[model samples]
Target chain A: MPMNEIWNRRLKKYQSMLLRYSKYILNDHFVLALLFFAGGLGLAYSNFVRNLPQKAFWWEQPILIIILFLLLHVGKLASLLEEADKIFLLPKDYQMKDYLKLALKHSTLVSCATQLICMLVLAPFILRGLQWSFGMWCTLLVVQCLLKLSCLTLVVTSAYDTNVKQFLQQFCFRLTLLIVLAVGLYLNLILSLLFSLILAVVTNYFFNKASQRHVFKWNDVVVYEKGRLMTLYRFINMFTDVPQIVGQTKRRKIFDFLLRSTSGNIYLFLYSRSFIRQSSFSGLFLRLLFLAGIIIFFSPNYLFSLLIACLFLYLIGIQLFGLYLTFEDNVFTHIYPIDESQQSFAFKKLLRKILLLAWIILNVIAVAKPLFKVEYLLIPVISLGEIYLITGIFLRNYIKKNT
Target chain B: MTLKINGLVGGYSRIPVLKDISFEVNSGQLVGLIGLNGAGKSTTINHIIGLLEPQKGNITIDDIKLKDNPKAYKGKLAYMPEMPVLYQELTLKEHLELTIMAYNLDPADTWKRANELLKTFRLDNKLDWFPANFSKGMRQKVMIVCAFMTKAQVYVIDEPFLGLDPLATRDLLNLVDTEKKRGAAILMSTHVLSTAQEYCDYFVLLHQGKIRAQGDLEELRSIFNDKQASLTDIYLGMTQDGHANE
Candidate 1:
C-alpha cells in the first residue's frame, strides 16, 4: 500500500479505538471536558514555572511534576494495552509489516506530542538557568525527546520480542544519556550539542534495530500492553477528572460483622454486602488513606488549614461517590431482579454510614498530628456535608424511581 | 402457592430473546423447562426470577406481582443462574452466611439448615474452601446448596445439571423431591429433557422464545400421539413442527 493509504488506514484504526475508548475514558462528557481543562491548567502551570526566577532551583516542584507525568504515562500505557488486547484484529496481520510501521508512526506522534508540550512549557526557565540560547534549547529539547521516545520504543520492542538484550541496551543508553546530560549542563554549548547529537544518534540506531527485530507474538503484546494499561487506568482513576475503568475485586472479610445485625430491608442487606465486598468501594478506602497520608506528610500550617480541610473533604467526597458507583456496574446486578428504588435507598444509607465512619477515623488521625488543630467549626460543616450527601442520594434515588 | 409468569418480553438488549413467555408451577411440583440451545428457556427463568424486566408484562409468585413488589416476591424465590455466581473472596460458609442474611431466615433455622445442607450436598468437607479452587461441579453444588439453604417458597433453577456428578445430581433430585413435598414450587430450566422427564410432574416446552406446549406427561403425550414415548421424542416432534413453521 502507498504511504498515504497506510496512513489513512492507520488513522481509521486509531479513530475507531478512540471511539471505543470514549465509552469508558470519555464516558462522561464532563470528564472529557475536565481532562481538557486539566491539560490547559497544566500548560498554565508549566508557564508559571517557566516564569519563576532562574535562581529558584525548584527541585521539589520539578520532582513532583516528574512524578505526576510518570503516573500519567503509566496510566496511558495501561489503557492503550488494554484496548489492544480486546480483539487482536488478527486478520489485519495479513499486512503485518505495514500495519506495524503505521502503528510505530502513530505511537511516535502521540508520545512526542505530550513530551514536547511539557518541554516547551518548561523551556524558558530551563534555558535561562542553563545559560543556553532559544535555538540551542529547542534543539536540545527535541533531541532529548527523541532519546526518550527511543527508550520507550525499545521497551515496547523488548517486551514484544521477549529480548533480554534490549533491556541491557535500554539501561545502558539511559545511564549514558543521564551522565552526558549532567556534564553538558555544566559545560560549553558545543559540548551539550555534541552530547545531544551522540545521544540522538545512539537512540536512533537502537530504535531502528529494535523495530526491525520484531517477531509478532500477539498474546505477549496483548498481555504486556494490558498490564501497562491497567497500571495507568488504576492511576487515572484516582483523579476526579479522568474516567478510567473501574474493575471489580474481592473485598476483605473484616466488614462482615456489620452485616450480621440487619434491621433494614433484605435489599439493604444485599446492597450493604455488595458495598463491602466490591473492589471499587475498597479502592475508595485506599484512595482516602493515600490522600490522608499525603496531607500528613505535607503538614501545611494553620493559614492553609481550611484549604487543607477542603481538599481532604473533597477527596473523601470523591471516595464516597465511587462507593456509590461501585454497585452501578452492569455485571451481576443487571441480571438480578433487584428493586432499584430499594437498592438506591439501601446504597444511600450504607454509604452514609461508611462515609461517617471514614471521616471520623481520618479526621481524628489528622488532628492527632501536632501541626494541625482540631477545629469544632469544621465538624458541623462535615456533618452537614454528610447529611447533604445522604439527602442528595435519596433525591437521586427518587428521580431514578420516578423515571 | 404457585409461581406464574405471563407475557414476559425481554432479553440482553433491544434484541428480544424471550417473547410473550408464560408458564406456571404449582406448589409441590418439580417442573422442567426444556428447549434447544438459544431457545429462550433461560430467559424465561430470568423473567420469573425477576432478573430481566418484562418489557410487555408481569410475573406473579404466590399471587404476588413481581413488578409491584419484587423484594417480597424475591424473598419467596431462590435462583441458581446458568453459570454459578460465587463470591471468590468468600468461603463456602461465608457464601451460605450471606445468603442466609439476604433471606433473613431465623438465625437458628439458618444454621440448622446450613449444616444439614452441607452434609446432604457432600460439601461438609469443603466448608472453608474458597470457591476459586472448587471444580465446576463443586461450584454448581455450592450454588445449589445456597439456594436449597434458603428453602424458599419457590426455586427457579437454571441448568442445574450442567456440572454435576451422578451422585450430586441424584442428591439434588432428592432434595427437589423433598422441597416439593414441603409444598414449595420448583421451576427448573434445562436442555436435558430426558433427565428432567422422570422428576418433572409437568413440562413446558419453549421454542424460539415462546411456549409451544405445556402440561402433565399425559397431556404432552397425547399432543404428540406418542404415549409411553420419552420427553425427548415429544420435544423433537414439537421442535420439528416449530422449525417447519419457521
Candidate 2:
C-alpha cells in the first residue's frame, strides 16, 4: 500500500462522485441564473472600482489582502477515510504517517487551486486598489501557498489536540501570520517572502513533530471526513434528491400549534406534521420565506417586490415537493387504506397553506414599510395570483412529472 | 372472512421470488408463515400487503382484489411489519389518531381501545412522545398498538417478535389471541419456532419460495411420519429434506 497510490485512488473516487452529483446540481437553468447574478454583480463591482478616489489609503490594501487570506481558509484536508477503514486498516497503523502526509499534500494542492481561483476573482480589486506590479502579485501567490500549507498543517495538528489550548494557540498563530503577511506585503515584499519562508519551516517542524507523537485518531478523522462528505451531500440535496443524505428533524414545539387543528384526514395530518417537524422541508421553507421577506422589504418598487415574493413562493413550492417522497419507502404508507388521490390532495393542501402563509408575511412586511404607497396594495393581489398558480398549476406539473 | 393467496409469484424486482405460493387463513385462525432467510417469507408478505405487485397471481381478502379495489382490500387488513415503520414527526397518540383516521374507525370506540392497548403495552405515559427517541422494542410496541388499534378483518404481521421484550412479546401473543377470539384472521411470519408452534392454529412451512408443507401440528407430524416430533422437529426435517432434494 503505497501512500500516494491510496491518495490518488481516494481522490479520484471522491472527485468522480462529486462530478456525478454536480452534473445534476449545475443544470442549465441554475447555470443561467448564476450567470445573470454574476453579471449583475460584476457590472456593479466594475462601476464602483472605476469611480474610486485617487488617494490610495494604507490600511485598505492590508485589509483586502487579509480578507483574501481568510477566504482561502474555507477548505479542509480531505482525509477520504471511511468509517470502515478503522477496522480494515488498523493493522497498518504504523505506516499511517505516509498516508497522512500524502493526504496533506493532496489537500494543500486542492486548497491551492481554490485559493488561486479566489485570488483571480479578486485580482482586479487587488490590482486597482494597491497598484501592485505583476511580480508582486506572484509573490503574494507564493505567500498564499505558504499560508494555506500552514493552515492545512494546523488543521492536522488541531485534529490531534482538539482542546481549548490548541484552539487558542492556532487562533493566535493564524492571526500572527495574517498580520505579519499584511505588514510585510505593505512594507517590503522581500521581508514578507523571508518571513513566509520562516513560517513554512516552523509549520513543517510542528507538523512532523505532531505526526510522530500522535497516532491517528480514527474516530476524529472519520467524523471529519463524514462531515465533509455530508456538506457536499446536503448541498446536492438542495438541487436534487441525494439518496445518501438522511434528513434531520427538530422538535420545534413552537410550531406545534399549527398542527393542533387537523383536517381529520391522515394524509393531511401526516404531511402537515412532517412539514413542521422535518428540518429538510421546514428549514428550506423558512429560509426561502426569510429571504423573500427581506427582498420584499427592501425592494425599490412594488413590482420588483411582487416579483421577488412570487419567485420565492415558486422556489418554496418546488423545493417543498421533496417532502412527498419522505415516506415512500415506509411499508405502513403502502398498507394504509387511504385513497391514492388523498396523498396528492393532502400535499397540495399543505403547500397551498404554507405558500399562503409566506405570502401573507411578505405582504405584511411590504405594507409595514414607511414608504408604503397606494400601489403597494397590489403586491398582495399579485402574490395571491402567484401563489395560486404555483400551488395549482406548477405543483400539478411537478407531481405529474415525478410520479 | 378469509384472506386468500391464490398464486402469489412476486419479488422486489422483475424476477419472481415467490413461486406460485398459496395459502389461506379463515376467520379466527392464526396461520404461521415460517421460512429461512431469503426463503420468500418477506416477499410473500410484501405481495399480500400490496407493496410488491404479483407478476402471476392474485390475492383477495373477502373476495376484494387489491388491483380492483385497493381501498377496500387495504381497509380489511392491518399489517405489523418486522421493522417498525413509524413517522418520526408524529407522537404515539398522533400515530393512533392517524391510524384511526386512515381506517375511518369510530373515534370513541377506537380511542377507548387505543388507550387500553397503550396501557397494556406500558406506553400510556409516552402518548405525546415521538418515535425519534424510542428504543427498538418500544418502536415495535408502537407499531403493534397501531395495527391492533384498527379492528380490521385480517392482520398481516411479519416477524412481530424481533425487537419485543419478553413482557411485550407475551402481551403481543395475548393480543393476537384476543383478536383471534374476535374473529379476525391472522397470517404471521416468525422464526421463533416454539412460539409459532404453541400459538399458531396452522403452520405453512415455506422453503425456497415454495410451500413445503402446511397443516396442523398432527398433520405436519404425520406428513413427516414422525409421531413424536414437535413442530420444530417437523420444520427442521422439512427444510433439510428440501435441501436434500435440491
Candidate 3:
C-alpha cells in the first residue's frame, strides 16, 4: 500500500476503535457533545477565575504554564499509543524506527498546539498580574513552548521502553521544566535563551536515542496492551453497561456454604450458584460499602443521608438487575435442561437473597453508627423499600419483554 | 442405568436450536453426535448435561431429571466444551481438585485418577502450571483430564478433538473406549465424522436443529439400498437430500 493510503487506513482504524471503546462511557451523541462543551466552558471558567499564576518565586508564569501543558499531553499521547504499540505498531519490529518517527511527529505537533493554546490565552493576564514585561514574557513564551515540545518528545519517545519508566519520566520532566523556567526568570534573557537552546539540543539527543530502542517485544506488548485495555473496558462496563464475562472462579471454601445443597428449588440453587460466581458484582458491592462509608463520614444532615442512601439503593437494584441480564446470556444456562419458568423464578429468588443480604448489612452499619440521627434509621428502611419497588417493576417488565 | 429422552426440545433462550431432539444412551454404549456447522449438536448435548433449559420437553439421565434434581443430576455427568474452559488463576492440579470437590469424589480416588490421567495425557510435568500458560492443545488435554478424572456416569463432550494433537486425540479416543468398556455412557459431538465412525457404536446426525437420521453404521447405510457406505457418506447422503433436489 502507498504510505498515504496506509496512514489513512491507520487513522480510520484508530478512530473506529476510540469510538467503539468509548461507547459505554459516552452513551449518546448528545451526551458526548454536551460533555465536550461543558469541558471547554469549565476550562475557560477556571482560567478566568484563577487570575493566572501569581507567585513572585522568580519563575515566569507563561513558561510554567507551557511546561505543565506540554507534560500533560506527553503522558496522554504515550498511553494512547501504548495500545497500538502492543498490537499493530510494534509487531513490524524491523521498521519500528519508522513508526517511532511518525509517533513523535504526531505527538510533538499535538503537544505544541495544546500548550500554545493554554499559554497564549492564560499567560498574558497572569504575567501582567505578576508585573512581567511583555517583551520578556513573549521571549519566555516562545522559549517555553520549545521546552515543552522537547520535554514531550523525550517522554513519549521513551514510553515504548517501559510505561512505568516513561510515566515517571514525564512527571520528573515537569519538575525539571519548572526549575528551568525559574532559572530563566532569574538569569538574563541572553543566558535564558542559551540555556533553552542547550535543553532543546539535549532533549533531541535523548528522543533520537529512545526512538531507536525497540523495547516492546511482541507477545509481552500484546499481553500488556490487553491488560491495559481490559482495565479501561472493565471500568466502562461498570457504568452504562456491556456484556461482562460471567466467568466462574472457585470461591473460598468458606463461601462454599452458599453452594450447599438445598432441597427446596433446584432452579433456585442453580440461580444462586450462578449469581455468586458473577465476579464483577463483588466490585459493585464494594462500591456500595465505600459510598456508605463516605455518607457516614461526610453527609451533614438527615436529608443528605437519605438522598445518598436512595442513590445507594438505586445502585443495588441496578447491580442485581445487571447480574440477571448478564447470566441470562450465559451459555451454560442455555445448554442445561432448565425450565424457563423455573429459571426465571430462581433468578428472582436469588436477587431477593442478595438484596436482603445488602439490606441487612447496610441497616446494621447505619443504625450502629451514631453519625446517623435517630431519623437516619429511616434511610435504610426507605432505601430497601425503594429498591424492592424498583426491582419488582423492572423484573415484571423484563420478564414480559423476554417472554 | 440408561439415560433416556423421549422428546428433547431446547436451545439458547427462546430461540429453539434443538427441536424435538431425542436420544438414549444405555450404559456401555458410545454414541457419536455428528453434524455440520450450526447443526444443533452442541445445543443437544448442552441440554442433556443440564447446562441449558429445555424449551419444550424433558431429558432424563440415569433416571434423574435435570430439572428435578440439578445437583444430583450434574454430579452424575461431566461436560467438556469445545474450548477448554478453565480459570487462569487455577493450576492444572487445582482445576482437578475443584472438579473433585464439585462432584464430591472420594479424595483418594480423585488423587489416584488425576495422577493417572496426567500420566496418560503426558501432562504430569504440568500439574503446577497455570492453564493460562498452556497452549491450545495442552488446554484441551487439561479439559479431557479433568472430565475423565471425574469418573462420572455420563460424559457429554463437544468437539473434544478440535485442537488436540494426533497423540492426544488417540489417547482421548482410547480413554473414551475404556470408559465405555467400564459401562459409562458417552455422548460426543464432532465434525470429524471419520473419527466418530471408527469409535462410535451408534450415530446421531443432527441438521438444522433437528435429528435428520440416527442408527448404527450398517443401519444408517441401509437407508440407501445396497450401499455399504461409511458413516460420513450416509450422513452426507441424508443431509444432501434436499440440496441434491434443489
Candidate 4:
C-alpha cells in the first residue's frame, strides 16, 4: 500500500472532525457576537487610521514587524499522524518520505492561508499608518508567507533529525524569521522577500539531508504530531467539549489557603482541589467569568449587563456540572465510607461557592461603573437572585436529571 | 469470622462469574485467594467492596450486611484494587487525608501511622506530588499505604504484589503481619504463590469462579496427594487439571 494514500486518509478524517466541531464553535450566538465585535473593532480601527499623523510614527515599522512576526507563528505542520500509526505502518518505513512530503504540502497551504488572513487584517494599518503602496504591501505579505514556510520546513526537518538540540534549532529558526521580516519592514521589501525564499529553500534542503541520513523515528514523529493536535484540541475545548483533550493538571501551591476550610468534608476536598488544578474546569470558569466581566464593564445599559452576566453564569454553572462526574469511575469514591448523599450536598456547596464568587466579582464590576441610577441597584439584586436560582432549584433539577 | 461471604453469586452483568462462593476470614488471619486470569478473584473483591452487588447471596462484615448499614460496613473495610485508581488532581498528602476523613479515623493517630507507612515505603518525601504521576510501583505503594493506613478490621487487597519491588515487598509483608497481629482480617488475591505460601495462614484456590480446594498448605498437599509440593506446584497442578477435561 502507498503511504500517500494513508496520509490522504488521515487528512480527510482530521478535516471532517474539524468540520463537525466547527458547527459547535461557530453557533448562532457566537457568530452574532463575533459580527458585533468585529464590526465595532473595524469602525474603531478605521477611525484611528483616518486620524493618523501625516508622517510615519517612529514605532510604526518596529510594531508592524513585531506584529507580523507574531502572526507567522500561528500555524504549524499538521502531520495528522495518530499514535497507532507507528505500529500499524511500521512496514512502510521506506514510503515514509513520501508520506511526509504530503504532510508538508498540506501544512504549507494551511500556514500560508493563516498568514494571508492576518495580513489582510493588518492591511489598513500598513497601508494608512506607514503610507505604503499596494504593491509593497503585497510584497510584505509574500515575505511573511515565505517565513511561515521556512518555519514549517524546520519543524518537518526536526522530525527526521532527532539528534539535534530541539530548543536551539527552534530558537535559531525563529531568529532567522525575525531577521528576515525585520529587513522587509525596515529596509528593502523585495530584497527581504528574496532572503525569505532562500531561507525556505535552505530549510527544505536540510530536511532532505536529515531524512536521508536518519532512519524513521516513528516514536518521535508520533509524539510531535500528538503534541500539535493536543494544542489544537485545547483551543477548541474552550468552546465545547473535546473528548480528546484530557484536562491538564498543575500544582498551584499558592491556592492551598483557599482549600483550608474544606478539610473534614471528603467531596468538597476533592472538588475544590480538582477545580483549581485541573486546567479544563478552572480555565473555563475564568474564561467565562472575565469574558462576562469585560462585556458588562462596557455595556451601554444596565439591562444588557445583567443579561450578559446571567447568560455567562448559566454557561459556567452548566460547564462545571461536569466536575461532578470526574470521580464517578474511581472505585475509591464508591468504597469510601462517606454517606453517598454527602457527594451531592458537597458538590452543590462547591458549585454555590464558585457561582457566588463569580456573582460578587461581576456585581462589583457592574456597581463600580459610574452608573448611579436607583434602577441600577436591580443588577446586583437580580443577579443575586440568579445565584440562588442556579444553586437551589436549578442545581437540584440538574442533579436529578443527570443522576 | 470478621468477614464472611455466604454462597455469593455475582459478576459484572446478568451472567454470574462467581458462583456459590463462600469464604470466611477470621480475626488475625491472612487468607490467600489463589486464582488464574478470569478466575473471579476480582469479582469477589468487588462484591466485598460493594462495587458489584451479589446477584444471589450476601457479603457481610462483622455479621452486618452492607445493605443494612453501608456506612458501617464500608467504614470497617479497606480495599486496594489490583490497578491503582487515583484522582489525577490530588496530592499524596491529600489522598491520605481523604482516606482518613472517608473512614472517619482520628487524624492525629492516623497521621502518625500514615507517616510511618510513608517512610517505610519511601514515599515520605513525595507527599506533595500527585501519586497518579508516579511510576507503576510507586502508585501501587500509594494504594498500599492508603489501604493499610485506615487500620480497618478487614482489608481486601487484590494482587497486591504485582508492581512492588523486593524491598517494598518485604516491607509490605511486615506491615501485613503487624496488621494481622492487631486482629485485622486480610483477604489477599495474588499470583505470587511462594510468598503467599510463606505468609498466608489459609489458601482459597479458585478455578473458573468456583473454589476447587481451600485449607492450609498441608491440607492442600493432602488434597492433591503430594505432601512435598510447594504452593506454586500445587497451583500449576490445579490449572492443568482444570484444562485437562476441556
- Which digits, one per residue and each the tens of the lDDT, describe model 4 over residues A1-403? 6888888888889999999989888873545544655776788889998999979999989888789888987887888877888788888776777888899899889888888888899898899899999999899988888888888888777776557798887888888888888888878888898999999899888888888865887788888888888888876776677877554799999999999999868999999999999988898899878778877787778887777777778778877887888888889999888788888889999999999999889988887795577767788888888888888898888788887
CA shift of B156, model 3, Å = 2.3
Task: For candidate 1, give the DockQ.
Answer: 0.29
- The whole-model C-alpha lDDT of candidate 2 against the native structure comes to 0.82
- The predictions' CA RMSDs to the true structure, in order, are 6.2, 3.6, 7.3, 2.7
Model 2, residue A218: C-alpha shift (Å): 3.2
Please give the range of 10 consecutive residues that has the lowest summed lDDT in model 2 chain A: A28-37
* The 10-residue segment with the lowest total lDDT in model 1 chain B: B86-95
Please write out the lDDT profile of model 1 over residues A1-403, one tens digit for every residue. Answer: 4544745765777577556555665454335434544665677677776676757464733453343234224212221333453355554433444544455556666767776776775665566554457887776566555545555555445534545575576568656655555554545546756775666566556545655655555676667666655555565455542354543446456776887764455456555665666555556566655655455334445323334444455455544554445435323344343455666677667756665665665555455554344563464365557546644764475445544
Q: 1 or 3: which has the higher lDDT?
A: 3
Query: Candidate 4 chain A: minimum summed lDDT over ten consecutive residues — where?
Result: A28-37
Give the best candidate by DockQ. Answer: 4
**Model 2's A-chain: what TM-score?**
0.85
Native-to-model Cα distance after best TM-score fit, residue A56 in candidate 2, in Å? 4.0
Error of 1 at A146 (Å): 2.2
| lDDT at position B215, candidate 3 | 86
Q: Write down the TM-score of every candidate.
A: 0.73, 0.87, 0.65, 0.92
lDDT of 1 by residue, B180-238 (tens): 99999998888877778888999988899888899989999998888888888899998
Index of the highest-lDDT prediction: 4
Please identify model 3 stretches exceeding 4 Å from their true place: A2-75, A78-231, A243-302, A316-321, A324-330, A333-403, B1-24, B34-77, B87-134, B149-151, B165-171, B191-198, B203-246
Query: Interface RMSD (Å) of model 4?
Result: 0.9
Cα lDDT listed for each candidate: 0.65, 0.82, 0.67, 0.88
Report the lDDT tens digits of candidate 2 across residue range B17-135: 88988889999999999999989998888888888888998899999999999889999999998888888888887888888888989999999999999999999999888875799
- Report the candidate with higher DockQ, 2 versus 3: 2
